[model samples]
Target chain A: MSDVTAGALESYLTGRLAADVSVSDLHEHVEGWSRDTVSFTARWNEEGEQRERRLVVRAESDAQIEGDSAAEGNDVETEFRTMAAAEDTSVPVPETYWYEGDRSVLGGRFFVVGHLPGDAPVVWDREQRQDLYRAWDEREANEGDGKADGRAKGGSENDGGSLPSQFVDAAAGIHTLDAEDVSALADCPPDAVVERELDRWVGRYRASTVRPEPAVEECIRWFRSNPPEIPETTLVHGDFRIGNILVNEGELTGVLDWELARIGDPLYDLGYASTYYFAGKLIEPIERPELACSLLDREWFYDEYERRSGRVVDRERVRYWRAFSAFVMMTIGLAGVHRFRTGETDDVRAAWFQYIVPGLIEDMLAIVREDRL
Target chain B: MPYLEPAAVLRRFSRFALEEIRPAIDGEERFVRGQVGSMASTLRFLAGELDASERAVTTQENALHEALDGVEHTLDDHDAAATAVREALADARDTLDGTDDEAGSRIRGTRERETTLLEACDDVLARVEANLDDETARAVRRPLYDFLDARLDAQLRTLGRRNESGDGSP
Candidate 1:
């Protein structure tokens, strides 16, 4: 809730588009707690040519940037730069249009990106998945590339089938990005990213309340005791999942939400995606067969990634990341917990997360126990 | 002393918030209606647990003692091993629950300890449970399960998919 009005947004876009920018439509999406997404359509003229463009402006809200007190460098500028760096890569990122680096203009800095066309529906919907699988199956039989164009009537297929393989391939694509490509990426302390995130979350959660969670404390102790081997460092999409990426014409169109994108161990993304998948299964009680789950299990996922990337996968490292994913999710809950407890945000999602911190710790411990035993 | 219990009044308001007043609320906060519904359920749970949590903690403590006692019978006849386990549990629990001024303190200072009193107790209990045999472990964990199971259920109700009602059938 900055006092930056719709007129300010129009002025900014008008300068960027270099035309008479009149915002035809403008509305902020209420879902994202981290970044407020304002979707708008601008009608502008450039050199006697009139062009209407649909775009999205992502503005940072108050959340600890891995424990940053104020949203300083972790604003829309960072995402704008990251997207610009990732443009030439195989990764399907949105085209970054303009970044308002100075916060004074918009009251808080914001970035605009051209909205890519893709139907990014619920990823875990069995009916949607079944359709995607059937489309791929059809594509394999008829098309030369054997890649589905994301068009098929869902619900007939028994499993996700080849869709899982494609998803893995797309994930590995991010991992395969050369460090030289993302040259502007900051250098992290060697093998300290996990510990950094752990401390960051701990700081946030501790700040939230006088009450403490023993499970998380124990998990942190365990994490400190048994540090995993650092696999090759690459551009890790801090949040990677079916929901984060757009699926269009039966292929991954674009990866969305660059807010959490960073350069780190590729396994970070794998762990995050896997934990998210595991959490969904726990909550939704989807009736996918046990064998189907096994097919898309962590090991299978690693193997698929290894085969695609031509890099040898470490069993221990993958296991650690899988559990670490849960730990990260648990830590992330602390931010929401802090917001809820402080009554700064009236988000029920925040309140719900505050209530579920214990359960999150429980889930993390369960994953760690499974990994260990 | 009153016509209706305080919790009953809370439950009435909570139910009203979920079923009646929530549908009328719209926009961003409208999405939080389901969570508000969850909060209502949690309030009811807290009210129910208020009188019983002390007993639950005592039962868990006794369960831990019983688990150690079982280990002695399973291994040795002497009370040395059983006494040691009992002392260990007490030491962990006291360190967790007691302050610097209190007796048998395991903590250096009050603020030095990272986890809360209950968290410390849970850590000790978890460690104790992890060491025991299957039967002893189940015996030790049953009380904790009994205690937190209801709480977990209440919290879990909040985690359900928003905008979804009834059976999520295909």
Candidate 2:
């Protein structure tokens, strides 16, 4: 879509890969919301023998939440650096092969990584989700398992099932990383991580809002007035949830979309994934407790995080971050509405995000005030 | 001449999505069809609530005005920037509040829409909170914040507490 063609990719890779590398089997991905994803086969001659490399290239695109540059969506560099850091860690990440920020390389900046074979299921796709959940149900029925962050890598083709414990384990895996060890992750000044994060989304909000949002403004003031006590900074996967996770044959695969991953309160990610969603899902359960339970209930998710990460989670800290997460999400909606009204994209879903801003405000108030409106 | 009722059209389209569109598509397209179905239902729901919605808005706005002027919750100072915005909104609101006979047709019809005042209020409050000191900001902004939150709560109430299946994708 961005003048990215097979021939152009081949030309770029031919020089980058080897003397005579041929790019073929190229197809532009149709599923992602943010990045223009391209998956192709690159063949190269090494020692007079032909070798094929399966690669997925993440093309640099404008931020999905244009208002929030700090948002975890649509940035390629964050994903590349984060993946590089997680290369040898307990966190399962796709091997990043080569990254280039120079736009001149492929008409825009893009990064190539070894393609991990697994499907990162879209949550909106109810049919596929039902199938996956059914698989989870069968597994849970037989195994009697709901252990948090189950590390067991096992699944079958039909079931396309995975353990909820495994997903939590993956989150725990990222939380377990020593922030200092990952050279790619920058260190926040001691105890200023959350404030720095607040500045990030707040700046992004001010940059892209189409209209003034008093609810968000109030939430911002509240966060500033009531800073959560941060004991430590760990790798925060800004959007750590089932949607960004890849699953294959019930095995926990690599985490995708590291654009929002940052160094901050690790609990922020936990509250973010659960509070931003699950509140409604928990209400309906939609007849998929098997899948929902695997991911978890509210209390279960909190307990699991503490149990697996071996980190004490202060409820107030979570409450504060939950409010911030809601603010970040609301601003993203504002940006989306701006883009749509300005005709940046035609998706009505952008407007859909704005509609939920009211409910999310209620959610934030519930967390921050502990007094429901 | 006869025209199809809007609700009927939505239901017709909803049926088409179920019988023709959803079955005919696959991949993201099929999932989107389901979303279309969800949206169709919500729109139908909204259409049903439209009469009640207008009343709900009036009720909420009246409460907000009462709250804005309530003695117990009053701001210590107008805090200039916030005052400008609130004064402007008050003007807009007064224009809309006038009886049709009491004001010229042009003023009654087109001086400023009611939602415009509401948006201006939000804009003013947004600016006020960002710039003022935390103590002064909290005091100046609380009534407006409470009003907006209550307005949202009332708005949701009109919609009948239906938990919308929001953007299914992250």
Best by lDDT: 2
Clashing pairs in 2: A72-A259, A72-A260, A149-A165, A149-A169, A150-A165, A150-A166, A155-A249, A161-A250
> For this target, which candidate reaches the highest DockQ against the unseen true structure?
1
Interface RMSD, every prediction, one decimal place: 8.1, 7.5
lDDT per residue for candidate 2 within A7-37, as digits (tens), equals 8778878778656877788766655556778
Q: What is the iRMSD in Å for candidate 2?
A: 7.5
Q: Write the per-residue lDDT of candidate 1 for residues A159-276, one digit (tens) a residue.
A: 2335455567668777776556666566555387666655655565566554654455556656765777674677777777766767776656788776676667777777677553
Docking class of 2: incorrect
**Global lDDT of model 1:** 0.57
DockQ of each: 0.20, 0.18
Predicted complex 1: CAPRI docking category: incorrect
Per-residue lDDT of B1-170 in model 1, one digit per residue for the tens? Answer: 88977656776776787777777777557335656766775565555444344444444444444443443354343322434345555665465344433452344432244233445445544564445454454444444433333333333443442222112211
Residue range with the least summed lDDT across 10 consecutive positions in model 2 chain A = A281-290
- Give the lDDT of residue A6 in candidate 1: 65
Over the stretch B34-143, how does candidate 2's per-residue lDDT look in tens digits?
A: 45655555554455454455465555556556545541233445434455545644653564355223454345422133354356556546555555555655565556
